[model samples]
Target: MDAPPDIHSLLAVLDRDEWFSSCASDLKLALVRDARLLRCLAGEAVYRDGESARHALFCVVEGAVRFSSALHDGSPSLLVYLEPCHWFGDISLIDGSPYIRDAIADVDSQILCIPMQSFTQWLDQNPKHWRDIARLSTNKLRVAYQVIGEPGALHHRLARRLWLMAHGFGSRMQNPSLQLSVSQEHLAQMMGSTRQSINAALARLEGLGLLVQGYRSIELCNLENLVNHANRLGGE
Candidate 1:
């Protein structure tokens, strides 16, 4: 367990989030007034699949959360790692459904949580928000379809996955470098491949002069190359 954030700090974090920016002014005030700041330490579960809690949406304010599920044998399956300012939990909001995956902190983290009712009130006035939700669902479905339809030639898939991770979750630094803080095994699971497969893919990418890999991370040396690789393998 972690300490809760005070109103001032929470408001500061919400100010930078794109989702919060899109919110109506009244909705923003309600969230700022009512949202709880939750602190989760590294490796702690924020929420698990198949459990009920106070209904709320979560936005990471600092650190990262790894969203994952389980395998048929009850082993863990890594899905996606969300970075700070990323929004999650709307699946529950959309259908009042239980979480299908676990949201675990990748590091000591703070997140803003707003009650489901408050979220609904906001969405009611901002029904256009549904379109954003639909786009998210469609993208996930597209990923699932790729996994189901094209199971081989995994190195290509790995390249595309890395491209997406860098573009989405990673940040560009002053050195003009882009990198993702992730484990090879986690990346492997996200691509529905094995750890060995992930290693091979990284080796391939490194050989191509696209990135430099380190423990639990990879720095993109040439982002345009990564983007072009993803596009070339886009159909994968």
Candidate 2:
């Protein structure tokens, strides 16, 4: 694992992040200066479902965090993974409510947290900045809607989900990531399908030379082709 990231490195990441890039210069400075770094071990819960909000905004600086909620059967369901440069916890921060899902470190992770007090103070000073936070929440909702609204067979859906993960949802990364630290089981959970079905879907992609599955990871071999497959309007 990599060493914990320092504030300077965190600032560099925030400077390039989509949401932070849109903030006013002064607000950006405040966020970079006031942010605190949190290091979490694998499987550690950063925040639990129904827990009182930390009243802070969070961004994954390094590694990944999983957002999950329990199903009606009392089983935990995987909502999504937040990778580097992805901001979360904004919904609770915006509405002054408890977190609706659990945020856990999927692996050893470095998280940047800007305390709610600092956020509130900044917003109070310039209420217009609230729009930035609203954009954060809405962006996530838009991605979720896209995923839920995708029309296709399992393979098509899987392709889109993989593409989304590699891009950190709506990260707008110039070069999308080639590797994903996700297991077939996690993919199955995300798709609400069985492991056997996920395995079959992965096999289909593999056959098309789109990806290569590792022990618990997947490497995209042809992002262009995969994206084409994902966006294809007709059934395959």
Candidate 3:
């Protein structure tokens, strides 16, 4: 795999991110100044469940992060996989609440961490960004609701998620591939199913020639067909 992009260039792209376009120039500049760039190898914990929500928003510069929550029995359940240009931890940052989920690097990942205090101060000074922030929050809530409302077939959920992921990350790639480096267990947790189910679904997709599964990655063979499957499953 190619080396991750430089943090400064990544930040420049993120600053012009759709979610940040409405933000004031000064506020955006301040955020860029306050952000800390960090890298983590695959499987490293960016933040554990129940950890203090001191780190504000995290913008994925390269690779992916898996956001998950722990069960009462301490088993982790995956919530979602966030990729480049997408962000996480904004809810905790804005509300002054504890992080409700853990964020783990699913691959060698680069991220920009913004401190909550600085984010809040910048927001206070630039009220215009509040509307954009609210829109972003609402969009997240809608996605969460969709995921929760449909907990049935594994293939169905995976299809929808793949579509979303492709739209978020693949739009920028010259030959976009919805390849994922995570395990079946993590995928099952995110889909609210068992590993067996995820395995079965992957087999089915492979049989359809929609995906090519490898030891460490899954290469999307037919992106359009996969998206069509998602649309059908999601009732879109």
- Against the true structure, whose lDDT is highest? 2
Candidate 1 lDDT tens digits, 172-234:
111232767888888877877789978987888799888899989898888778757655754
Kindly provide the TM-score of model 2 when superposed on the true structure, using C-alpha atoms: 0.92
lDDT-best of 2 and 3: 2
Q: In lDDT terms, how accurate is model 2? A: 0.83
Candidate 3 Cα misplacement greater than 4 A, ranges: 1-8, 15-17, 21-24, 169-177, 231-236
Best model number under TM-score: 2
Q: Return model 1's CA RMSD, one decimal.
A: 4.1
Each model's lDDT: 0.70, 0.83, 0.72
Q: Which candidate do you rate higher for TM-score, 2 or 3?
A: 2
lDDT digits (tens) for residues 107-195 of candidate 2: 99988877788778878898887888788888888888989868888899899899888877877556478989898888887888889
Candidates sorted by lDDT, best first = 2, 3, 1
Against the true structure, what is each candidate's TM-score? 0.79, 0.92, 0.80
Question: How does model 3 score by TM-score?
Answer: 0.80
